[model samples]
Target: MRRNVRVAAYAVCVRDGRILLARWTGAGGPRRWTLPGGGMEHGEDPYGTVVREVEEETGYQVEPVALLGVESARRVIPRRGWRRSAVDHQAVRVMYEVRITGGELRSEVDGSTDLAAWHKLSSVGLLTRVPYVDTALRLWRDRPPTGRAMGSP
Candidate 1:
């Protein structure tokens, strides 16, 4: 198996009892709601990455207020084509609490996410979403002093 690692940043923007989410259309899976952020560019700071991703996905300029926590997940993906080996995938996600600074709400065009919208925090579970959404929210709500989610390594 081949090992693959990805590090990405995400923002949890909450206002008026709602959370901002972008509908991810990548990964060739069903579209699902996720935080408005993504992988960093080469040599890019995670702080800059979160700001850039949020703007690209949701048309909002955001300023990260605090570093909430970091979460890591690992999984195995079987080979998809001939001569390819199974992949041991690990994702290191950095979560931040951000506040919107400017820009109108709009969907990204020809990007990984198609739609951006605000959903009530209480009703988030009713929608189809990526697991990252919940994990990130927990980090935001819990705000553990250690900067790690409860029970997380």
Candidate 2:
């Protein structure tokens, strides 16, 4: 059995009690609201990836303010559709909380997302945010772990 893994970066751009989100139009024709970010390029830092992705997708410059958290999803893929084969796939994503530094909001003409907007924090749960968005929000809402050094004597 072979497994495929994908690493992606996402940003939770929050401002004035709202969070920036993008509407992702998938190949399957389903649209989903997601945090502003995307996959990391080869040899690119995760933080940089988030900044570039946010700018590219939302046309806003963002600076990562905090390291939120990481999430992973694993799924089995059929080698063939019903009559075909099977495969294994896993997707790992790192999410961060970012603050807008500059630039105005504009959608990229050639992008996976069709729209970008800020949604009220209180209404986030009511919308169709991607799974990682919720995870990132939870991490942001909760303070990071605090303790002594791992190997302190």
Using all chains and alpha carbons, the TM-scores for the candidates as numbered come to: 0.97, 0.87
lDDT of 1 by residue, 1-153 (tens): 899999999999999999999999967889999999999888999999999999999999999999998899999988877899999999999999999999999999999999999999999999999998988888989998877887676
lDDT of each: 0.94, 0.81
| Candidate 1, residue 55: how far the Cα is off, in Å | 0.2
| Runs in model 1 lying further than 4 Å from the true structure | none
Clashing pairs in 2: 79-85, 79-86, 80-84, 80-85
Q: How would you encode candidate 2's per-residue C-alpha lDDT over 1-153 as one tens digit per residue? A: 667888899987778999899999876667889988888888999999999999998999989987777777788976744555565888778878788899999876778898999899999999975677777777777745631112212
Q: What is the C-alpha RMSD of each candidate to the true structure, in Å?
A: 1.0, 5.0
Top-scoring candidate (TM-score): 1
